[model samples]
Target: MDNQRSLWAAWAERLRQRFSFILQGQCALCDRPTSQVFCQDCTRRLQACRVQSSVLQIAGLPPLYSWGYYEGALKQSLARLKYGGRPQVAEPLGQWLAQVWLDSGLLERGLVVVPIPLHGDRQQQRGYNQAELIARSFCEVTGMPLRARGLIRTQPTTAQYGLLRLERYQNLSNVFQVGAALQKSPNLKDIVLVDDIFTTGATLKSATETLQQSGFRVVALFTAALSERQIA
Candidate 1:
């Protein structure tokens, strides 16, 4: 039974990979043919908006780094990934983020990458965590170890969109807890929190505080895009 299960799993993975390759050949922004998620024209235009400073400060949280302002082609691509069931969009977006991390001279040899976790019920509904998909791609390009099980969302919260800033913070308060697997490993030091977008810093701050309370040092927050309101 185990051997049969393994065979089935391998076959499933191959199918997933084949589908991803076909998806990759089409530009995510304009639907033009290209070898990456974004075609050459879209890539050039998107790269023009790269954030000048690689690091940003959020009130009472670790320094955050983002690839670019969440607008134009980048914004549409993220929306597709997060809401349109386009998991393949994370690949090129995550590669760009990983390149930014490397360019910032923050690529430590042993730093662990942790994706912001979704509540169990929410993840089941979405079929996958968008942050995890991006983090997996980031790890693949950077060769960094991903520690997704380090943190788990303990409670489901209402969506932060359209909520007041204070409400957003309150919504996420005390919602994250260190996972059992990570609690068993006491040697974890430096960590990078990966997320698809940085809107109000509520989620990252809550997760960072949870890890810190557990004696883990969250070195930084790395995200694909920074919301326009936050950038303003």
Candidate 2:
């Protein structure tokens, strides 16, 4: 039985290798023949965005930790993953994000990773929640268990594309809702809200307020990057 299992495992590994080579022809950014989803050149070019990993607590809002400003290759990558329905993109990018947190010596004590939940309708429309994918990958890399329950968007929100700055905040003010099944061993007494981007900090603020009201002491907000379209 063990011998048979090893043979199957080896075959699976070979299959995966072949599949990867088949799927990956050229770097999306540089058109290089690299195993990396994004070529090394593109990865290095994305380093222009760097923000302090330390905590920044907002009044009446949870402490926020933005990886950096979203630009260059990051914008393209996120667009591909978010709008283009690319799940594979989350693997490399999310792993890099976890490494950034680990190298920074963050992901502190009593850490819980709660992805910002998408509205059910929106999630269905998108086919998957990009933030959830990143959070799942982050958990796999960090060994931190993920909690996606009880936190949800109560309803669909209007498009934020051209909304005024003030309107954006107002639109998301009461968008999220705490799930009734907030009961769990690792309840959100201490958690880090995960998301793909932080624009006006409005979404984080709103989610923070809801969690705190539910007595979950949300300590931090972690986003892959910050949105450049933030209202001035």
Pairs that collide in candidate 2 are 150-179
Question: TM-score for all predictions?
Answer: 0.84, 0.79
Top candidate when judged by TM-score against the true structure = 1
CA RMSD, predictions in order: 10.1, 7.6
Tens digit of per-residue lDDT, candidate 2, span 1-232: 9999999999999999888877777665556777777777877876666554434555666656666678877777788888876677777666766876686666577677788888898899999888888888888998876777657899788876678879888889888877644556444477778888877777778888888877787766778887655312
Question: Which regions of candidate 1 fall more than 4 Å away from where they truly are?
Answer: 1-25
- Whole-model Cα lDDT of every candidate shown, in order: 0.86, 0.75
lDDT of 1: 0.86
Candidate 1 lDDT, 67-153, residue by residue in tens: 988888788888888787778888877898899888888767768889999999988887889999999999999898888778999
The CA lDDT at 7 in model 1 is 100
- What TM-score number comes out for model 1? 0.84
